[model samples]
Target: MSSTTSRRTNPVDIIVALIGAAMFGLVLYLRSIEVSWYPVLLLVAAYLVFAYLFFRRQGGFGGVANPKDFYTGIVLLAVCGVFAAGMFDLPLGRVARPGVAFFPLMLLVLLFIFAVAILLSGLRNRGEALGPVPWRGLFIITGITVFFGATIKGLGFVPAIFVTGFVSCLASQKWTALSATTTAIVLTIFSWLIFIWGLGLPIALCGSWLRTALVALGVAGESIPFCY
Candidate 1:
């Protein structure tokens, strides 16, 4: 039975995988010489299609009504879609002097591979009981992430981080507002110190409006660089 299942050929999977492999090769070639945005975008798109087809063929969501498989598959697909969309128009650098998107694109490819493994494992263990899905927690965390991304530019790094962290913590039933606030504040400060001050990262501590207000109040220098 196992052999028969393994021997079963899904033409869609084969075609998609072939296309993905071709795209991967092209990406590698482009990386070796001159990197461009379009080719990389194409590669990512091909990979996404391949992933969808492959997972769908592998008894989609691990044989229907399996919440664990469904959740895992959905999360992986969502992440891949987000990454591809975010990186689509970004420039890709050369092999010697790679651009900002190079490493991230590579990492995203690895993430796709990892997601495939997860899907395969889920398929193999389809018989196992997948407990109830935590819809509240999932939605809460996702909302917090979206909120952070949307508000970060306007609120600046510190405030955005604190708000997101506190709200995300509240997703857990055990956390209270006070505890979440304290933890969020401490974590935000720690991250600021570590990533900004100690590491000399160019993260903005305050937005333009806040900075202007502080300067006007004589609380900050007029020439406040966005990075603290």
Candidate 2:
């Protein structure tokens, strides 16, 4: 092999490998402070595995021939790393009963497996060139998420989901005002029935803020819609 032969390392893979290395270092530092968690061990093992792959030039780290799978793998690997870290805070209970993070951790594991499979495919099969990102859809979805989170408590689930559904429908650029409004109404009603009536969950239809604002404008409690 010529010394001048350029290595075709994927930038995405390099980024992921670097992240894993950083995480490994962080976990070690955490352990130094007595934050010895189970996920920390798993993450250490994961980091070592990636470091092995990265150095050996296996799993597309040698050269990413399939950019699409490489990038998708990077995204999923990032997701798994983030959520897996969060699992450190939750207790992994026994078989008779599961902790809050048990199911989520299991799901993350499954996601990680899938991500690994997708990554391995890059070593054999070549995928089509990646397309331009759907910025419009991404922006709309991100805005919707932010709105839902910000308003779910203050605006209440009913109005928040309704507005979310409504805006979501309109985001397609094909939904008319009437169509979006109708879909929002149906979505809101069905969700309310399933979550509130059927499950008997303690989600409020309207929040106290709405009632206070309405009352400030001279609307009585009896006149407020679903605020009682």
Model 1's alpha-carbon lDDT is 0.69
TM-score of 2: 0.50
Q: Residue-wise lDDT of candidate 1 within 1-228, one digit each (tens)?
A: 233333333464455445655656666765367876666667676676767766677666535333454457568867977997898777767878878888888777656655554444445443335557788799999999999888777678888888888888988979987999899999898988898789987668866666767878998787776633
TM-score of 1: 0.43
lDDT of 2 by residue, 27-67 (tens): 33432233434665577568658655754564444456466
Q: What is the C-alpha local distance difference test score of each model?
A: 0.69, 0.67
Deviating ranges (above 4 Å) for candidate 1:
1-129, 209-228
Report clash pairs, candidate 1: none
TM-score of each: 0.43, 0.50
Model 2 RMSD vs true structure = 10.3
- Write out the backbone clash pairs for model 2: none
